[model samples]
Target: MGTRKTKAPPPAALGRAGTEKDLPDHFKNYRHVWVFIELERGEVHPVSFELLGEGRRLADQLGVQLAGVVLGPPGDSTRRAVAEAFAYDADLVYLVEKPLLTDYRNESFTKALTDLVNTYKPEILLLGATTLGRDLAGSVATTLLTGLTADCTGLDVDADGSLAATRPTFGGSLLCTIYTLNCRPQMATVRPRVMRMPQRSNKPIGRVIRHDLRMLEDEIVTKVVGFLSDGQSENANLAYADVVVAGGLGLGAADNLQLLKNLAQTIGGDYGCSRPLVQKGWMAADRQIGQTGKTIRPKLYIAAGISGAVQHRVGVEGADLIVAINTDPNAPIFDFANIGVVADAVSFLPALTEVFIRRLAPGNHIRLVN
Candidate 1:
């Protein structure tokens, strides 16, 4: 999500100054909250459901319906996506099916989504901040001439029924809440794993409103010639990993990162680093963890030699168990970590690694503590 040049109001005052009664006559007609279900390559992205979970809450608070908007070619994948949206608690879904939408093209998707918005007039619209979402969201918002808050970490409805979108700003040093006070269908995009997944219920599929794409194939400028997969199987899968072990500048040298790798390997988990390690060229960009990088929700996160800044905090706070190993007793990581160990990470990691190796050795017959 790209930053906006407009100055945002401080968090304390967001949504307090405006009421829906103050909206223009046309804007007042906007009602439900809609999440764009990202269907790509015959599958729906999980972030779409995550947004639906959040949309459910905002809809209930405003006494409005929560809906999912799906754009794709008509088939089992599209059908399954609609059902999954209902399972994720969407009250209804707006589906636009066409051959041109078989693969995502910016021109086709932007037109289909904008047409739906203009016709249905939802009060709030959300999309995942993925590659496709970011591309389409900018066009849709620009065409509608509305305000969009990108990469929002929090979503809420104020007493006045305005959308309160909170995101990190000033280089992740602070968070601010923005309200699209004057626009209809307040737009926001959230990254994957930023919101908790909603519980799925085995409900029969709910209402589905079908719409047509009015444009012809010749009207679109871009064409999907072919798709080549990146095929990087060894690429970091930190976002969905159950266990993550990461290092920071505290390790003192790039070579010491192998200590973290050894520990992660012994425990059967992925390894990563803080943003500084990436800047220092010690780790690849994809392995960086923080607001600018990946947001993780691991079951167990072990951080070594890192001072937890606000940027890094937002990424890993969702971890079920956070263990911090830093030499400084007052490192910011200690504030939220479940366990804090003040020691040289280079030395401590190898010792901890050996203990795990021994405990899990063949015929050890010892169950590790949960």
Candidate 2:
């Protein structure tokens, strides 16, 4: 168990350099939009298909092809990933399978993807903002001397065929669109669940272009020694929960948070809190909700006393129905919440919990939202 090494800040990473010049002749041939299909443990992350859907839209808009770049061990894993990529709208799949790529090692993966990009150039590259994706994307983007926007909320192609990557900026108070005008392959990393998963099709896979893993084992510095799986904990599964009830700083005290938990349990929902509570030791870090926290897409979300700042808003905006309860009428939560209750959450929560508990006990058919 050794401490993981991190990349030191390089000079080029400090500022925008060589970004003004137009695309060179050698780079002008870059075509199509490509997504890095992240494969691990014989399964692909859903974010890969999510990106394929997005890349398909961009490719269609740019009048180019949508391709999935799969880098993994040579076997059924890679083949299955390619077929699934096609079902998810990828017009093509680029497979670079090798023994060294069986498990994710930064050195081998960077070289594999970079080699594919150098030989078969693509106009745009998309990756999920997962731990592995962020690590691989940074190394690949830097190696290619291109710009990459991380955790983009939106991705689109401009009229000129350049990538328009939009993400939250200024402490999540505003969203800004970024463009890699001079870069040959514009790159962006999207957080999971930020974009809706597209409908999978039974259509046949378009084409698979296989490439060789040219690097030797001796050239790689990092290696995956073993894998360790953590046991499941009792924390809320906020990311994919159908119903979530969360509280913010306005709950007044740590003890009062129990009211939210009781309500959430009564309604068969999980409970979480805003980031401030985590800092105050009132809630665990996993229970925090905001841009820096989990991006959730629950069917019903109840926020108690949480003022919806841009950071928190970005995380939970995908909820089908957001019920916000706060004393302040002008709270930012009111701007987007479908239901607003201008009442003291301290009293409101307990009363609502009692009502739901009573209704749930007998043969009463009831809608939980009052």
Candidate 3:
């Protein structure tokens, strides 16, 4: 909620500030990478483990350990989630079991994670870019007075053993790599499926370090009355779908989204729309696909009439293969898409639908590309 503060480089040309405080020597001892494992309504968010998978890579690159920080109610589910983290490749897991953290409120989780970080320092902290994660990450980074990068598309270890956080800038037109130079626990949030989920090891070996929540429930400001799920709707599950058929602004009319649906149904895939479709009320919010929308990593993605701007690019970059249908060859979508068809989406969608329908008819199996 507050503006992220970056430390101004001290006047190195001159002398250090007279009031400059010295950092403790123990600060140098801080090591390893950490992920803030997010749990909502007794379910461990998938993004949390996805981050652990990535954190494991960074930790291995830096030759350090990867730890997951989970804060929630004291129960078997919470413990089970910690063990799952280890199975997913976390070298260590820090658990802050407390009643105040039963539900995801900004204040309680922030306090718990910050306390753990301060007690046992880590060089890097990663979180998911979900609504709850963004809310919690911003507050936690602010509380620790550290640098926080949101919605990073990539994370890597720099030569100096620091986190190289790469994210889209200027509304996703370009990419920028940010560093927390003098800050500890450089924080970042990766959207769901932005990183691959590591294979769960059958060995399942890791240490669980339990921490205490010093703050009482009475001291917390926010309270959770109930948990409302995004389900109970007929919208297709695009995020987890094997195939997704999405239309963009190029679809021309609100009714044109039906063509996308027809193609989706032909292939037994989910149907979705670009941001404009959602804005025009042609589709629901859950069906929108872009940076501000759901991040999808389907096995196959069909983008019709989408210009493929950076905002939309970041959201779908994880797809195994992308097929673009647009009249313009110069469309940015062509750059990243595996297959391109320079045809009007309105005209081509139906043709493709018919082709796929005939191909999947009974025992017919054929591959067609355009």
Candidate 4:
């Protein structure tokens, strides 16, 4: 038998220089970087701040201003979102407040954001890959007739000043970088927890460019009948958890998941699985962790029986500590994990659980026999 060799993907082509001589006359006027501050039900999504942190880096690289675009009804929530944007290091903010914009309607938000982009002409635009952000980004990009990359995991500026957006492709087997060479505003959407949150400060509010939305309420087709919220108890909230324990196919049987849950319960953490377990119908989709699922930044991550492919690695690389346990010493998980153990996860998990129970149980202490 012969081992199969995989072909490597070709390198991405470089984009044109960002100089005035290289860009089209119309695109030449585009300047600065803008991140849409997604506000829903009177609260700003944390993904907005994450994008701002990334936008700040791109802006510094391009030597341009970093701005936040806020569109919502005039209220305390809107005002607070603007202030928070400034605190997150936005050089300025573009405000569009109207009663019609109270609830996010695709028609209203698309009009407001497209109008802002047309008027101010930013060179780069970023949005969170949330439900609201996805709807608005698609509509705005379509209306503006520009290229838009969805669910990007990595974003950067090329030497030629093009927006380099990297995302998983071919069912998360490979990553490819995309560029909008001729587009005026290079647009991309990033999922929550994919980028690190920026440090915020109590800086005074900076320059705000207010723009009035001209569209009337009756002109919009979509109406908000009422708001229905999901059950809070059912929510996974996996991305924000302090500690996480995950398992993969090497666990051998679906029944073994209880080991993962037991460990997670012992540590006061959350438990999840890789994409395969979800595909196998052994785990819920929300419990899947990978490029196509939740991206986490937990303080500690324990991956048992996982091979640690690039897709899985990208999702948990933000963890402060990673401990991998697998029977195969050559498992890819060992390459990046902070600690690696070569052992059968089925047997190791129960022993690890017992050790924790002995050490962490209240008023339980064992004398050492040195």
RMSD of each predicted structure: 2.8, 5.3, 4.0, 4.8
Candidate 1, number of clashes: 0
Residue-by-residue lDDT tens digits, candidate 3, 1-370: 3543334434661244334344446567779999888887778888887888898899999999989888889898788788788878888889999888888888888888889989999989899988888898889888988888898888988776778888776556777777776678889998887788777785475788989888988888778787656674574457778899999988998788889889988988897878877888888997888888888999999999999887788789889999999898999999999999999999888899998889888767745332
Error of 2 at 73 (Å): 2.3
> Which window of 10 residues has the lowest lDDT sum in candidate 2?
1-10
lDDT (CA) per prediction:
0.90, 0.87, 0.83, 0.89
Tell me the lDDT of model 4 at 197.
87
Better of 1 and 4 by lDDT: 1
Reference-based TM-score of each model:
0.91, 0.86, 0.88, 0.87
Better of 1 and 2 by lDDT: 1
- 259 Cα displacement, candidate 3 (Å): 1.7
Model 3 ranges off by over 4 Å: 1-26, 232-237, 366-370
Check candidate 4 and list the clashing pairs.
Answer: none
- lDDT sort, best first: 1, 4, 2, 3
- Which lDDT tens digits does candidate 2 get at residues 1-370? 3321223324563354234456678779999999999999999988898898898899989889999999998899888998999999888899998999989999999999999999999999999998899999999999999989989999987766678889876547878777787777899999877888899999797889999988999998887788875445574557768899999988999999999999999998988988888999999887778788878888999999999988899899999999999999999999999999998899999999998888888666555446
Give Cα distance to truth, residue 202, candidate 2, Å. Answer: 1.1
lDDT of 1 by residue, 188-223 (tens): 999888899889888779899999899999999998
lDDT of 1 at 111: 97
Question: Which pairs clash in the backbone of model 1?
Answer: none
Q: Which stretches of candidate 4 lie over 4 Å from their true place?
A: 1-21, 171-173, 226-228, 362-370
Q: Which candidate order results from sorting by TM-score in descending order?
A: 1, 3, 4, 2
Displacement of the residue 150 alpha carbon in candidate 1, Å:
1.3
